[model samples]
Target chain A: MGGRAGLLIAPRILEDVSRGRDIILVTGTNGKTTTSAMLRAGWGGEVAGNDTGANMIQGHVAALCASNASRAVLETDESWMAVVISSLRPRVVVLLNLSRDQLDRANEVRRIALGWRECLAPETYGGVVVANAGDPLVVFAAQEARHVRWVDVPSSWRDDAASCPHCTRAITFGDGGWSCECGFAKPRVFSASVGATLEIGGESFEWGLALPGSFNEVNAALALTALAECGVEVATALTRLRTMTTVQGRYGLRRFGGRTLRLLLAKNPAGTAALLASLDPEDEVWIAINAQLADGRDPSWLYDVDFDNLKGHRVTCLGERRLDLATRLTYAGIDCAVVDEPESLQGEGSVTVVANYTAFREWMGRSTPC
Target chain B: MLRVAVILPDLLGTYGDGGNATVLAARARARGIEVEVVPLAIGAVIAPADLYLLGGGEDGPQRLARDLLVEGGFVERVRDGAHVFAVCAGLQILGTTFSIEGDASYPGLGLVEATTTRARARAVGDMATMVSGHMMVGFENHGGFTSLGTGVEPFGQVLVGRGNDGHVDGYRAGRIWATYAHGPVLAQNPWLADQLLSEVTGESLAPWASVADRLYLERCERVSTRRSAGDRTAGRH
Candidate 1:
C-alpha cells in the first residue's frame, strides 16, 4: 500500500493535517528510526511519529493521519527530508551523522549533504537544526542553515568523510576532531557527551540509557537537545528517555526456535562498527544479510565492517546473502558456519543476531515473547 | 612473502573493494605463502609489491585518486610490469579519461587504452560473466560505460547483467586486469583471485576450491535465473 500509490497520496494528506503541529524531523544515514523514537519518548506533549521505520513521505502521512496530536516527531529518510520538511515546516530538524549507506539506491554522502544545504537555507527553512558537529557532512549541511544547535556526537566511522565535503581536501583528525585544510572544521559543539555524562550549557548531567552502545548515547544527546529546543526541560526529557526501552524490534530480546536472541540492526559500516564495539568478546554472534530491494542488493558493505572484532567468537552467517557474509568472515580470519534458516542457528544460549534492514525485519517478524 | 599494496583505499574503496585485497591476502596465506597487506594512504611513497590493487569510489575521489597517483609516479610502476587488479572506478582512473556527470571529463592514468563515459542510466544489479572460460559472479553498480580500444582485449563476456557497458565487462592486458564487478569480485570468484595470484607469483597455481566456489556457483545460478525470468517477462510484455 505504501509504494507509488502511497507516495502519490501523501502530499494531500500532509497538506490537510500537518499544519499548526510542532514537528521535529530527524534524519541521517543511520539511527533515524531510533532517534525519532527517542525524541518522541522524551517529548512531553501528545506526539505522533513513524515509529515502524517507514520514513518516506507515505509513512509520514500515515503516521500523521493516525494521530491528531499537536506535536509530531517524524523520522525522515535522508533523501526525502527536503520534501517532507517543505510540506511539514518542521519546527526542529535533527541532522545526525552521514556515512555511506545503500550506495546502490542512494546518492553519495556529499551529494546528499549538498541537497540538505539547499533545503535548509534560511530563506526556505527557518527552523532550528539540531546537528552533529562530529560529522563533517552534517556540519557542511547545517552550516548553511540560519540557526543550528550543534552536538558533539563521537563519530567512529571516518572512512566516508575522509575528504572534506566542502573542498574535497583530505580532512585531518586530531585531538579537537576533524578539520580540513580548506578552513572548514568541526563546528562548535552546543551539547557534548563525555563518558556517560552529557554537558549542555556547561552543566553536566549523567545519563544511563537502557539502549546499548555509545551511538545510542549520542542519539540520546541529540534527542535531549531536540527536546530542549522544543521547550521541554532537560531533566524531564532525560526521565522520559529512561522510560524508553526499545525502538521498533531493536534491542528486544525474543525467543525464537528455543533460543533467546537479541536483535540488533546494523545497516551500514558505521552502525555495524558501533554494534561490534558494544559486544562482549566472548559473546556468540550471528550476522544475517539480504540483498532484497529494501536491504539494498549490494552486500559489498560487509567488507567495510571491521569483522575482525568477532575474530575469536563463534559466528553464524544467515540470510539470502549468507554466503557473501560467510565469505567476508572467512577473509576477516573468522570461521563462520553458513545457515539457510534462522531455526538452524538456534541454540540454548544468549546469541546476538546482527542483521541488515530486511534481515532484521524478517527476524523481527518471527520473534516471540520472551 | 607476497606483499599486496592496496592503493589509496580510503579514497577508492567505497564499495567494499578493500575485500579484494583481503581475499588476495587470505588466498595467499592459505597456500603457505607468507603475505603482507600494505594499505598505502595518499601522499605515501609507493613501493613495488607482488600485486597492487585499487577499488571503486565516487567521482570526486576517483579524480583525486587519479591525480594523486599521477603526482606520485605510480602510473609508471603499473606500466613497468606491476601486477595490478583494479575495479570499477579504479578501472576508470586507469583509463585515458572518464566522463563524469555534466560533461566533465577527468584525466586518467592512461595505463589502459580505453575511455569511460557516464551512461544515461546506471547499471546496478547482480552480474554473472564468463571470464576466460571461467564463470565469475559478482555485483555491478556503475554509471560509467567504458569502451575499450581495438588493440585491447576484454577480460570477459557478459552472460547475465551489464558489464563494462552493456556488452564486454573488463580489460585484460598483460599483467593488468580491471573489472566492474565488486562482489569484492575476488571473494565470490576465487578462481579469478587465484589467476591474479598465479600471474604475480610467475607460477600456475592449482585450482583451490573452498566454500567460496559453491557460493559462487549458487550466486551465478540465482542471478542467471533472475535475469532469464526478467527477460521472459519483458518478452511477454
Candidate 2:
C-alpha cells in the first residue's frame, strides 16, 4: 500500500469475475469481438459479450447488467480496459493483437499499451494477463508486469508490427512468430490449435469452424488458452469448442425462403484481406459497400486488398456509398450488378452477402420468409 | 454466390468493428453461401455489388477516410445503385458533412446530405433500437450529434434506449440507412443482416433468418430465467 494505488471504476464487473465463477476479459485493437465471442463459446459461461459487436464501457456494462449469474465472459475495448480493470480486476484478461485502430481518440497503439501497462502494473498479483506473444506491443506490456501468462502465437503471424520494446529494434517474423537480434522471442508455447479443433458442451471435436481463415485459428487459440488458464480442463474446454456457435452477424449461417446467405463484417485492410483470402474458389458471391464515417470516412483502404482473384462472381454495390464500393469493384474487372434493394434480389447459387458492421446486420435482420 | 465489398475509411481497426465483416462472411457460409469479400479502397478498381456495409470508428479516422472517399468520387457512384447500409461512423460519413469535436467539420460523402456533430457527452449504452423498415434489434454506442437533414430521417426509434444521436441518433435517407448502435450490430441481429441481404438479393425477407431474432428473444428470456433461478439459489446460499 506504500506508493501504490489501484483504481476501481467498474466494480461490479470485476466482482462477478473474481468469485471463482468462469470469467474472461477480451481486449484488443481487432478480433476482440470474434475472440471474446469464441472465448464465451469455449468457456460457455452463460455466454455474454459485445455480440452486437459494440465493444465499449456501456456495452460490457450492459452485458454485466444483463448477466444473471456470477460467472460470465466479457469483452472490453482497449480504451475501456484501464477503467474496467481499475474496478473489475478480472481473474484473467486476454489481450488480443493490437493494431492502428481509431485515429481520433487513441491514435497510437503505444498509447493503448502504455495505458494498459500502467493499469496492470498497479495490480501485479491480481489477474493473469493472457496476451498474444507474437505481438510485440502486447509482449512488451506483459513484460512490464510482475506476473503474466503469455499465450503461444500460431506459426503464422501476418502483418507483424514488430519493434524492439527495449532497444527499439524492428522485430521481424521468420518461421513461427517474431524474433529480433535483441533476443526478444515469443516464448509462450501450446499444443492444439484453436481453429483446428472444435469443442462442444462436453466433447472435443476435430472439425474446423464453418468459416475459413487463419486469424480465426488464432482467435480460437486465444480463447482456448484463456479458458484453460482459468482452470477449465483442456478436455472440457475442447468440448465447448466443438459446439461453438456463430454470434449472429459475425459468421452466422441460415437458410430462409429457399436461399442460403453467409454474412461477414469487413472494416479494415487486415480484416478485409483475411475476408478476401478466406473466400473459396468454388463459391459464388455478392458484395455491398457503405461509405459512412462509422465505416471510416475515407473508404480508401480498399486498394490494399488483392482483388485480382475476384473472378466469376455477381457483385452488387449498395449503400449511400455504393458507388464508392462499386467503382472499386468495377476497376478490378469483376462484373457486378447494382441492386437498390438487397431484400428483393434472388439467388440460386451459393450466395455470400458482405457488408460492414451495420449493413451486414441489416441484411441479416430481414424476416426469413417461408 | 456471395459478394461482399467493404467501403473502409481508416478507422477499421477500432473496436474490432472489422470483425463484423468476418463474422458476416462466416455466418453466410454456415448457410452454404459462397462468399467473395472485396475491399474497395479509394482509387482502387470499383465494382457494383449486391450489398454494401459500413462500420463505426473514431472521429479522426472518419475525417481522414472522408478525404480519401471524396477524392475518388466513389461514394456518389456507389450510392446510385447498391442496396446500402451504414453504421455509426458510416452513417455520419454518408451525411453531407459531420463536425468533429464540435468545431472542425468535414464534408461527408453527401450521399445522405446531413451533418453529424460530436456530442458533448457520448451516448454509450445497451439500447433497444426498434427495427422499423427491417425486422431487427441491436445495441448503439456513439458520441456524435447526428441531425437528419430536410429529406433524411432514422430507420427506427430508440424503443428502450438511446435514440440515434444520443437522444437524437438514427437517420434514414431512402435506401441509405444509418444509426449509432453497433449491436455488435450483426452478431445479435442476423435479421438485420438478412434485411440488408434482401435489399441485395431482391428477395423477400426469409422467416428462418428470424432464427437469430427469436434466439435473441429466447436468450433474453433465458437470462431472465437464469437470473431468477440464481436469485433463488442465492437466497439459499
Against the true structure, what is each candidate's TM-score? 0.96, 0.55
lDDT of 2: 0.60
- Model 2, position B28: C-alpha lDDT score: 63
lDDT (tens digit, per residue) of candidate 2 on A1-370: 1101111443364344345445577888667777776776666556555576556555656665555666667777777777777655577888877765433345446667767777778454367777777777787666666556666545332322434545444466766677767888776544335445543234454645544577777677677767877767766665666565565555666554557777777766566666766777776666666645456533434544556656765566665446445444544556666667766776565566667655665667762422
Question: Relative to the true structure, how large is the alpha-carbon lDDT of every model?
Answer: 0.85, 0.60
Best prediction by DockQ: 1
Give residue B171's lDDT in candidate 1 (0 to 100). 95
The sequence of per-residue lDDT tens digits that candidate 2 reaches over residues B1-237 is 767767662343344344345545655665566777776643455566655667765555566556666776667657676656677778788787787744788788878767777666655434454566443444445666767767566677544445544334477666676766554455456666656666666656434532334435643453355445542122110
Question: How well is each residue in A314-360 modelled by candidate 1, as lDDT tens digits?
Answer: 89989888888888887787888988866655458888989999999
Q: What share of the true interface contacts does candidate 1 keep?
A: 0.74
Q: Specify the highest-lDDT model's number.
A: 1
What overall lDDT, based on C-alpha atoms, would model 1 receive against the true structure?
0.85
Which DockQ value does candidate 2 get? 0.03
Sliding window of 10 residues with minimal summed lDDT for model 2 chain A = A1-10
